[model samples]
Target: MVDAHETFVIIGGGLAGAKAAETLRAEGFTGRVIIIGDERDHPYERPPLSKGYLAGSKERDSVFVHPPAWYAQAEIELHLGEPAVDINRETRSVTLGDGTTIQYDALLLATGAEPRRLDVPGTRLAGVHHLRRLAHADQLRGMLTRLGRENGQLVVAGAGWIGLEVAAAARHYGAEVTVIEPNPSPLHGVLGPEMGGLFTQLHAEHGVRFHFGSGITEILGQDGQVLAVRTDDGEEHPAHGVLVAIGAAPRTALAASAGLEIDPATGGVSVDAALRTADPAIFAAGDAAAFWHPTLGTRLRVEHWANALNGGPAAARSMLGQEVSYDRLPYFFSDQYELGMEYSGWAPPGSYDQVVCRGDVGKPEFIAFWLKEGRVLAGMNVNVWDVTDRIQQLIRNGTTVDAERLADPTTPLPE
Candidate 1:
C-alpha cells in the first residue's frame, strides 16, 4: 500500500530530523525523502557538545548520529549548509536559500534552537564562547586545554545546566572556574533551592567558585581579546576566557511566517499528539514543537536529547497515518566530575509541594522525588543505578504513597 510517488521533507539538521528520515525508510516508505539543514556538518547529537566532547572524553566522530555513508545508503536526499528560507503552504513548497524551491507531499519542521547570546558589552571579543554547534565544541576544547596549561581563569555566565556542565569541564582541564548566576542558587528554575544546593555544594567541593545572586553586566577586553567579566554584584572577575551558557531560544520565525499555529506560552509550533499542525500536511517535532502530550494533559516543549531521539520516530509513524500518542515524559542526564544524574518527569519550582530524598545525602547517592499533594511528579537519581522505569511508571500512574514509605530506602516501589 506504500506510494512511491509521495515525498516527505524535513527541515532540520539536528537529531530529530535525521532520525525521522531514518524511521520513514525503516518503515518501508519507498518514496522520496529529503532533509534540509542550515549547518554544513551532518546531523549530530548535542549532549556531548557540553559534556564528553567538550571535556575531551569522546571523539568528534562519536557526536554524529550516523556514519556519513549511511545517509547515501538510505537514499536520503541531504541539502547540507542550505537553509530552508520559506515555506509556501499554498503550493506545499519550500524555498531554499539558494532560490531552489522543492515541492513536498508532507513536511516536518525540526528547526531546533540556538544559544541565547548575552546582551552585555564586549560580547564580540575573542575568547567569549558559546557551545551550541560542533564547531563551538571544537573551539572550546582547544581553549580549555590551553587555559589548563597557562593557568588561566574561565568565568561562566548563568548557573544553568550548560553553565554547570562547562564549569565542570573547565575544572577537568585543571583550569580555575567561576560560575555567576542571577538566582539565589544554581538550576533554580527547574530544581528549586532544595536540590540546587546539592549541585552548588558539589561544584564548590571540586574547587569551582559560585557567585550567586549575580548577573554579568559587561565583558572587558583588550586588543580584541577577553580580559575579565564584570558582574552586577559590583565585582570583576579576571578571565582569559568566558563561556556564556545563558540558555537557548527556539527558532520559530519560519513556522510563524507560514501562518502555522504557534503556542504563545512556549513559543513553539503548536501541534496535536500526532505532531500535525493546523495544516494536515505540515508537522513538527523536537524543540520547535509545543505538542499536546496526551498523558500529561498539557502542552510541553522539551529540549532534551531523549525527546528528539524518540519524538522523531513518533512523528514519522504519524506521517505514515499511524495512530500515535506522544506521551513520553521529559528526561535528561548530566555528568559533572564524579557525579552522574538522570532526572525524569517535569516538576517546576512552584508546582511541587515538597522534595523527598531517599538514601544518604552525605554519600551524595540518592533518589529525590518532587511530589504534589503526595502524588509523584518528578524523580531524580544521583549516583544511583537503574530504577528509571519504576520512577516513570509512578509518574504515569500518578501513584500516591505514604511520605515515610517513599523516603525509606528499604521500601521497594510497588508494581
Candidate 2:
C-alpha cells in the first residue's frame, strides 16, 4: 500500500469524490489528499434535487455531505470551483484550469455528468432550463417563487426520472405541468412498456398531462421568454417555461485527454472489475466509469445514486491495495408525485420471459418481478418496501425462489 505521505489527487467533488476522501481517512491514510471540483459549494447530496428538496420540503444546507468546516478539520484540501484540465501521466501530475499542476502518486476521477439539452429552435431562450446542478435548482426555485401557482405552466421535454420528478415538484408548487415524451409511455425506455403504462396513469392521476408518442419540433418563445412548445404531431401547448431532462453523457474529457480507454458505446471511461482504468495509478467510479459485471457478462454504466455511494468505497478499497471488486446489486429509486418506486438488479435486454405483477396498479400499490428461466432477474416495487428490500437480499445471497411464491403476494419471501 502507498504510504500516507504519498500524495493523492481526486478530480470532482460530487458524492463519489467525497466518499473516497472519507473512506481514505477512515482507513487511516493521512496522506496529502486534494479534491478538485468546478462547483464552488461543498460536496452535497443530489437525490433531493428531484424530490422533497425541489418541492421546497427540505432546506438546501441539509443536503451537504460535509459543511465547509469539516473539510478543513479533516485536512482534505478542497479546490472548489476549479476544474482539472489536463493530466500528464508521465510526470504523475494533473493540471487545473488555472494552469496549476499538482503531482500525485494516485489519482481518482469522479467527475459526474451534465444534463442533456434539447436540440431545437428557441432552446437558447431566457426561460429554457435544464435541471442538473444546484444553480439550476436555485434558478427554477426563483421562478417558482415569482409565478405563485395560477397561470404558471411549465413544459417538461422528457418523461425520464429527472423530468418526471421535476414535473411532480412543479405541480406541488401549484404550477400547471405538461410532459412531452417521444416514446409511447413516459418511462417506456427504462422500465418497458407494460410498467411504463403504470407510471403514465399515476402521473395522469396527479393532474400532470402527458403528450406521448410525439416529438418536439421547436420551443416557442416571445420577448426572449418561453411561451409554448410545438410537437411534430402539430400540437402546440402553452408553457411559462421548459425543462429538458432527456438524459446525460459522461464528463470524460479528462480521461480521454489522458489517453485512457473510452467506451465507444457509453461514451464513458472504461474500467476493470477493480475499478482501475488503463493507467494503474488512476481509478474511476460513479456515472463516469463503466465496469463489467461478472454475473451478466456485460458492461454496465450506472447513473444512479446508490451505485455511486456503494462503488465509491469499493473503489477506494481497491485503490488502497485491497483485492476487492465492486459487484453489488444495482438499485435505483424515484419519488413521483405521491408514489414511491424502487428497482433492483438488471434484466438483460429482451431476456425476461414473463413479468409477474402483484397488487393493483390502479390502487397505487404494486410490485413487478421479472424472471428469466425461472430465476429472479429484476424487480420493480411501487409502494412496496418490505418485499423490495427482502427480494434484494434474496438476490444478493443468490437464493433459489419459487416462481409461484414470487408471483403470489400472499406468501412472504422465505428466510
Candidate 3:
C-alpha cells in the first residue's frame, strides 16, 4: 500500500501521465505527485493533430486533456518544458533538464514515441515536414493554407493513418495531393491487402493520387523549399510540400539507461500484464510499453490513443499495489473526410487465418472480422456505428462464430 507521505513522479506529460495523476487523486492518494514534460504546453490529446486540428475545425483549447488550472487545483505539480534527462534506479530519483532532482517511491515512464524521420537528401527543406506534436500540426496547417491559396501540391511520403488523414485535410483545403507507399496498398500491413484496397479506392474517389510499391530515394527542393520527391523508379513527383508518416519509434533512452528490460521486437520497455517493469518500483505505459497481452498471449505494444487513455489508469492502480490486470481489449479509431472507422481486438502477426465481412466492401458501411479456427480474433467497423460493444464482447468471450452467419447482416451478433 502507498503511504500518504510517499512521492510519485511521472516523466512525460502526455495523456497517459495526466490520466495517471488524475487517477491517483481519485483513488484517494494523498502523496506528492509530479509530472515533467518536454513541451511548453500542458498535456493534450494528439488524435486531432492530423484531422480536426490540422483542418482548422478544432481550436487550440479543445485539444488539451485538462485546463491549466486543473493541475493546480488537483495539487499536482507540473514542470512544463522541463524534460527528464536521467533516472537513477539505485536512488529511485529522476534528474530534470534544469539540474533538479525529484525522488519518488513510485515512478512512471510515459515518454511516448517520436515520429520516424526520413534520412534522405533534402529532408531538411522548409516545406518537408513530419506531424507528431501540436506545433508540427500547426505548422502544417499554415503550410496547407498557404499552398491552398497558391494551388500547390502536397506529396505524402507514406500512406499510413497520419499521411491519409493529412491528405484528406489537404484536399479539403483544395490542395492537390499524392500519396506514395512501399506496400501494394494503403494500410496493407494492418488491414491486409483486400481491406486496405478499400481505403485506396476511397482516396482515389476523392481525386487523391497514389504511387504504390514505390520507395523515395530523395526529396528534391529549391531555395530551401520542397520542390519534388524522387522515387526509386527514376520518377519525380512534383510537390510544393511533403509530409512523411513512415511510423514512429518509442522514446526509451531513459528506460534503457535505468537498466529496465527492453523488448527487442518493439524497442519499448518490457512489462508484465500489470504494466510493471522488472524493477517493480517503476512502471511504463502508452506507446513506450511492450506488455504481455493476456488475450493475444504474447508481447504487444500499441501506439493508439485508446491504449494510452486506458493504460494510464490501469498502471496507476498497479503502482498503488492494487492487484489489477491491464487486460482491456485494444481499441482505436480514425477519421478521413466522410469515412470513420473503429477497430478493436488484437491482430497479431499470423494469428488469424481468415477475414469475414458482414457488409459490402464496395459500399460505405461494413464490419470486418479476423478469425482463427472460427473464433473471432479481431473486428473493425467502417462507417458503421453502435456495434463496438458487441464486437468487443464476441472477442472477449472467444465465441465460435459461423462464417455465413457472421457475414450476413440479417443476423445479429451474439448476445
Query: Best-fitting candidate, measured by TM-score?
Result: 1
lDDT of 2 by residue, 71-153 (tens): 87878998999899999999999999999999998898899888887778999998888877887888887676555555588
> What's the residue-level lDDT of 289 in candidate 2?
89
Per-candidate clash tally: 0, 0, 0
Clashing pairs in 2: none
What would the TM-score be for candidate 2 when compared with the true structure?
0.96
Model 2, residue 232: distance off in Å is 1.5
List residue ranges in candidate 3 displaced over 4 A.
Answer: 1-4
Residue 284 alpha-carbon offset, candidate 1, angstroms: 0.8
lDDT at position 206, candidate 1 = 92
Taking all chains together, each candidate's TM-score versus the true structure is 0.98, 0.96, 0.98
Worst 10 residues of 1 by lDDT: 1-10
Q: After superposition, how far is residue 194 of candidate 3 from its true place, in Å?
A: 1.7
Worst lDDT run of 10 residues, candidate 2, spans 142-151
Consecutive 10-residue window with the lowest summed lDDT within model 3: 1-10
